[model samples]
Target: MKELYFRAMDAIHNACLFVAGAFLVIIVLIIPYGVFTRYVLNSAASWPEPLAILLMIVISFLSAVVCYREYLHIGVGVLPAFLHKPAKSFLGWILEMLMVATNLFMFIWGIKLCQTTWHQAIPEFPIITVGLAYLPIPIGGGLTVLFVIERFLTQKFFSEPEPETISQLTTE
Candidate 1:
């Protein structure tokens, strides 16, 4: 089970990296094209600005999921640091639960928003509906929620007991 979880995490991490790399490629190509069209041809590509914005949004959200899975989200941890070990663990559990609930809420709301915009087309990209543009919100949020739940369960129940000191655990 632990191996399976690690495999799943690796898969998610790889997928996120791929998405980010693609976004970078798209931006690199689009910017040059946009610049050439504007400076040389005295015309701009109609799609570049909006497309770049969409790509940025997707990349940011995808990166956020990776961060969440790694417990890399920024927080002021002064309170947690001051607490005793048992209390700190309890607080961590509660914090994880709250994060899970919040992500779930975002997932549900994002899906509803996408559904509501399903029939509405973009002004410039008429073939692509607003729903498609906004679809990443729900999808990314869902992935984040899944990763958080997996981490919560593993930490709260499945993980091995912690050692009294970091040095003790690390020593050969």
Candidate 2:
């Protein structure tokens, strides 16, 4: 069961990375197009800026999931550095529980937010609901919840779960 969960998490992490990267590429490509049309052609495009903003929201949320999974999210090192091994391990567990709690709040509230705004549509995108733009919040939060579960599972079965970068560094 744990192995299956770990495998699924690995796939989910990769998919999030790909989606975030694709959205970033789209933002990069379209911003210049918006600029060109505004400055060179003397007519500003209405859709590009709003679209880019929506894509950026998606990218930010999705990138956050990837960062959390990779252990690349920001952390205060000073306190942890002063602790002994066991204390540090306990602190790490405490921090992860906090992550779970925070993400749970995000997921619950995000759903309520989306439902509340579901009736509204963006002016530039009449077909897309305002809620759709905010969908990433819940999705990212839910995925992080799953990643946290994976981490807990991994820790139970394995000795420890090291960040990929650290493992690579130690190998070299």
Candidate 3:
């Protein structure tokens, strides 16, 4: 059961990473084109700016989910470092629960926001609804919730592998 869950999570993580990376590449290409069009051609393209903004939102949310899954998000560790083993354990539990609560709030409120804006169209891109632009928020929040559950389950049921030391890495 746990193996299946972990495999699913791995797939999700990779998908998020790929999406984020693709958007980043698009953004990189887009800004330069926007600049070139405005400066060299003396004509500013309207769609590029708005499109970049929308892509950025999606990239930010998806990247955030990937970061959380990989434990790459910024965290304050000084307080945890000072605590004893039992206290550290308790603190970790408290923090994880807090993260779960925060993600839940994001997911619930994001859906509401999307529904409220569902009828509104983007000014620059008439074909795309505002709701579609805001969809990444709830999606990311939901994915983070699943990842957090995976973390909880794996910690409870699985023995974590030991970290390799510098000497071990050097030998390999």
Instruction: Evaluate residue 138 in candidate 1 and report its C-alpha lDDT on the 0 to 100 scale.
Output: 87
Off by over 4 Å in 1: 156-172
Tens-digit lDDT track for model 1 on 71-159?
A: 54575578876888888788878877787788788889989999999999998789988998988888787888777767765664222
Find the candidate with the highest lDDT and give its number: 2
In candidate 2, which residue pairs get closer than 3 Å at backbone N, Cα or C atoms, i.e. clash? none
Separately for all candidates shown, the number of backbone clashes (residues 3 or more apart, or on different chains) is 0, 0, 0
Model 3 residue 38 lDDT score: 96
Question: What tens-digit string does per-residue lDDT give for candidate 2 at 7-59?
Answer: 89888888887887788889999999999999999999999999999999998
Candidate 2 local lDDT, residue 2: 79
Question: Considering summed lDDT, which 10 consecutive residues are worst modelled in model 3?
Answer: 163-172
lDDT of 3 by residue, 53-142 (tens): 999999899878876766657777788778887887778778888889999998999999999998899989989999999999899889
TM-score of each: 0.85, 0.87, 0.86
Candidate 1: worst 10 consecutive residues by lDDT? 161-170
lDDT of 2: 0.82
Clash number for candidate 2:
0
* lDDT score, candidate 1: 0.76
lDDT of 1 at 57: 84
